[model samples]
Target chain A: MINVENLTKTFGAKRAVDGISFSVERGEVLGFLGPNGAGKSTTMRMITGFLPPSGGRISVGGHDVVDQPIAVKRLIGYLPENAPAYTDMTVNGFLSFSAEIRGLRGDAKKKAVSRAVEMCFLERVLHQSVETLSKGYRHRTCFAQSILHDPDVLILDEPTDGLDPNQKHEVRQLIRRMGEKKAIIFSTHILEEVDAVCSRAIIIDRGRIVANGTPLELRRKSEYAGAITLSVRGVSASAVTQKLSQLSSAKRTSVIAENGSKVTVTVFPKPNMDGELTRAVIDATQVWQVEELRTEEGRMDEVFRSITMPDTAKSPESRVQSPQS
Target chain B: MNSWANIKTIAKRELVAYFASPLAYVFIVIFLLLCGFFTFSVKPNLFDRGQASLSGTFFFWHPWFYMFLVPAVGMRLWAEERRVGTLELLLTMPITAWQAIVGKFLASWLFLGLALALTFPVVWTVNYLGTPDNGVIFASYIGSWLMAGAYLAISCMTSAMTRTQVVSFIISVVVCLFLILAGFQPVVDFISGFAGPKVVDFVTSFSVVTHFEGFQKGVLDSRDVLFFLSVIAFSLFTTGVILRSHRAG
Candidate 1:
């Protein structure tokens, strides 16, 4: 439902969004992951027709954002990064005003306002002024305004920036539910949020798209497999490591910690490992108590750091491990 | 039909906003008090030699009255949107700039007119004390309303230029003062000494005061009507252009 082709936005000599291109299908939740100054908001503003693109074209539901801005704006609902709202207006008043602008009137306007108030859980504070609301409530109020018209496309820039953990969870659930129907492009720096909510992720760094794929696909492409952390009793760390080294599936093994009778060993296995390695470790270490054996789940943060950081600047010890293999 | 819908939505919300706050009441009370004070105390002494008509009392102080009142009403028209970040929401709406401009201008002008009408007790008082010309009274009211509309349009243009209400008000007052003083006798005299008398007369003819004075004298010349309407149209048109350019940029 949203197509951005080589969209570039430059402020003076600095390129905020440098030739970034991406398309989002209907009902797809695409997470735009980027650090600060990565042009996530700039790209969103271009799509919403809030800011003109320095180059290229953007179309929303078959309408060009530059040429057919009114049509494009009609199709998309945008929640800016700060959730800027009129502080003097009450929650209901603000939503109703937004509804009127969206062409919702009379019964339809009233119904849409109430539905949004309920969806954002803003029922009790409907009469209260927006300035008096807490940060979480303010964010929710903006969210309600965006969705009051039920536009076909929703572009949320850091939708859960200042909310509490519980509020964030609730909003994430709401976003997930909304994603089931609308095309959602949410920009966020939070890695776990992408994993929790987005079906596909696009990681941008320094005004460029560094990587784009599903979370698992990224992990697989990253060449970082799950590691097994084992705490063994009645065994020396060196002996355990020496025995694990003999196994073919064991890419690398190291003793993470050691106490009086217990030792923690982290084992990096080959990508396509079978059960042979686990069997070999268990069989070779007699009198060794297996306290913990779990694979290390790859986090989005790790993948982000690995791809964003310069390859030549990697530490020697990290280079020798070669987790991608 | 689309423009009507747009105007209805904007006007309804704007009028509601005015009534929701104390601004409308405050403006009306102050407006009536000032008009009464100027008419009973100031105008009587200044025009002691002449017959006290609505033209001398009401129309004389209108340009000055609107200089303050119009800015108070119009300063928030666009500045408030920028201050509160609602400008983004408003611009993103499907309505065109003309709809928004006309809607806001009409709402503000109506409120100002309501404030001006509250001073009818002064007109009633003048009618009671003496045989004041009713035609002159009617013309003065029309002139005041047109002048208020003209001032409001200028204020809207100034408000669209900045996000600070104080700055918008000050700039609007200064611009209005310049327009009013452009036709004053002393200013014309000073300019006539430098330029020719004919040039001074031509320049003074463009002043709001000159046209407003003609209307106060109970003459509704089409030229004066067109001048005030032209001023309103030009300022509102400029406001639309500025807002559209800002939105596009």
Candidate 2:
């Protein structure tokens, strides 16, 4: 339902979004992941027709964004960064105005407002002015406005931003549910949200896309993916490394810890291989009294950090700059 | 009609925005008080003039009064939206930029019209005192509203140029001041002393006061009406250009 090809936005001498190409179809939720100021909001603005791209084409629901902004906009419901709304208006008034502007009126407008109010959990504050609401309620009020018309496409920039955990979860669920029928693209800083709600995710850095794949595929790119960890009693670190190295599927082995007679080590698998490494590690560790053994599913946090900050991730000096270290 | 609906929705919201705060009532009361004070208390007071018409004492003060007051109402039109980050939401709506501009302009112009209309008591006073040229008074009202609209459109343009309301207000007042001062009696005389008749007419032609004076005399000249409307159209067009440039950047 949405197609963008070589989208670029330049502000003066700086390029805000450079050569971004992606398409989203119905029933797909594309999670946009990047660090702060990575052009996530700028890209969304271009797609929503708020900011015209300096180059390339964007078409939503078969209408070109620049050539036919109103038609494209009619099909899209966008929630901009910061979730801004009319602070002076009541929640109901804001929603009703949104509905009216979307061309819904009378009973249809009423139903749309009531339905969005229910969806956003804005019932308690319906009569309250937007200025008096908490950050979460204010965010939801702006969100409710976007969905009032039930457009075919929804462009949400940092939808979960400034929400509590429960509200975040609810919004994620809402996005996931609505995504079954509408093409949705939402940018988020939270890595877990990418895994939780996105069918596919794109990681942008400095106005460029660095990674684009399914959540599972992206996670599998982590350094520790499919690696086996073994902790055994009555064995030396060197003995465990030597034993694991003999296995044909093991690419390399590293000793993680050694205390008294207990040794902990991990076996890295060869590229493009699978469970064969796990079985071989199991057989090699069977000679000792095994305390614990498990295969690691690659972590999202590690992948996110490695992909975004590759220079400082693995060097000896990394510890000095690494927050985790 | 469809585009009209979009304009109305925008206008309605703007009107609601005005009345939703204390600013609207405060502005109206202040406008009425100023009109009353200038007309009844200052020299050439309505009673002393011995004229039933408000054209000289009451309507004469409108252009000067609107200079500051109209901008105050209009400064927030675009500046507030930009400040609150609602400009993104507003521009991304399905409506065209012109619709939003017209809607916001009409709403504020209507507001100024309402404030001007509340001075009907002055009309009552003139009517009760003696027979007056009601036609001239009505034309003055129309001229006053159109002049307010021209001022409001300038304010709208200035507002679109900045995110700060105070800056918008100040710039709008300055621009409106120049427009009023051009045909202002003293300024016209000052220019006429050195520039001669041709130059003087050229400068005064741009002044809203010069055109508005004819409306006060019940002279429904198309040129004057066109002058005010052209000012509105040009300013609003400039507003759209400013907003578009900002968005493009």
Candidate 3:
């Protein structure tokens, strides 16, 4: 439903979004992950036809964004960064105004507003002025406006930024459910949200796409991926590390924890030998007591920190973002 | 028809937004009180002079009143949207910048018209005092509204330049002041002494004062009407350019 090619936006001397290209199809929820000032909002703005690109092209539902902005805008339902709405208006009035602008009138407008109100749980505050509502209700009111038109494409910038955990979960579920039919793209600082809702996630740093993959695929980029963790008693920490390093399939081993007699150690598998390391470890630790042994599934924050935080990185390999993997 | 619908929807929203706050009531009360005070209590009192027509009494103070009041009414049009971060939402809507601009301008223009209409009791007073020329009073009201429209349009342009309403208000007042000063009676007379008739005509042509004079005198000259309409069109067009440049940045 959406296509962007070499999309770039420059604000005078600074390049906010640099040569970013990605396509979103129906039934896909693309999670945009980046630290602050990484141009997530800028990219979303360009996609929704709010900010014209300095270079490249963007089209929504077969209409060029710059050439046919109205057509593109018609297909998009956008919730901006702060979820701003008319503070002077009541929740119902604001939604009706949004519906009216989207060309929903009379009966159609009423149905749309009610449906959105129900979905966003805005029924309790229907007649209440937005200025009197709390932050969550205000945010929900803006969210309702976006979906009132039932647009085919949804571009939300930080939709769950200021919500409580329950509200965040509800919004994420709504996005996931809506993603089945609409091309949904949302940016957030929460990594778990990417796991919870996104079919695929793209991590960008300093206005560049550092990694792009499914949640599991991206987590595989972590150093602990495919490594085997062993918790055993009757074994010294040094002995576990020393014995695990001698195995042919193990590249190295680190003692994760050293209790009195119990030591938890993890073995790094050699390249292309993750399958053999488990069996190799089992045979090597036959004489020792193996209480718990499992392969690490890796972590999202580890991959995120490794890819985004370059200054503190101890290993150069984690810096590379292999989107195909 | 679809385009008109969009414009109407936007205009209605803007009009409702005005009444949703105390600003509208305050502005109307203040505007009416000022007009009444100046007409009855200030120098050249309406009843003391015993004038039958409202040209010098009721209509004369409109331009000066609108110079400051119109900007205050319009300063929030775009500035508030920008401050609330709704400018992004508004510009990204399916409507064109032209429609949004025209819709918002019409809403505020209609609002100024309403404020002007609230002074109809003044019209009744003039009619009650003596046999007044109702035709001239009607034309003067039309002229007053058009002049207010011109000032309101300039305010829209200034409002688009910044998110601060105070800054928009100050700049709009300054620009509208220049429009009045260009053809101000004293400035025109002073220029006529040093410059030729054509040069003086050229300078006064840009001022609302010169154009509004014809309507105030009960003459609906097409040229005068055209002057006010052109100011509205030109300012609205400039406002569109300013808004487009904002998104382009």
lDDT of all the models against the reference?
0.83, 0.91, 0.90
The DockQ values of the predictions, listed in order, are 0.48, 0.91, 0.83
Q: Per-prediction count of colliding residue pairs? A: 0, 0, 0
Note the B-chain TM-score for every model: 0.94, 0.98, 0.97
Candidates 1 and 3 compared by TM-score, better number: 3
What TM-score, over all chains together, does every model reach? 0.89, 0.96, 0.96
Candidate maximizing lDDT? 2
Q: Which residues of candidate 1, in runs, are more than 4 Å off?
A: A221-225, A233-289, A308-325, B43-52, B198-202, B245-249
CA deviation > 4 Å runs, candidate 3: A314-325, B189-198
Compared with the true structure, what per-residue lDDT tens digits does model 3 show for residues B1-249?
A: 999999999999999999999999999999999999988888788987888888777777888898899999999999999999988888888999889999999999999999999998998998898988899999999999999999999999999999999999999999999889888889988999989999988888888888888998999999988888888999999998898888787
How does model 1 score by TM-score?
0.89
Candidates in descending TM-score order: 2, 3, 1
Provide the global lDDT of candidate 1 against the true structure.
0.83
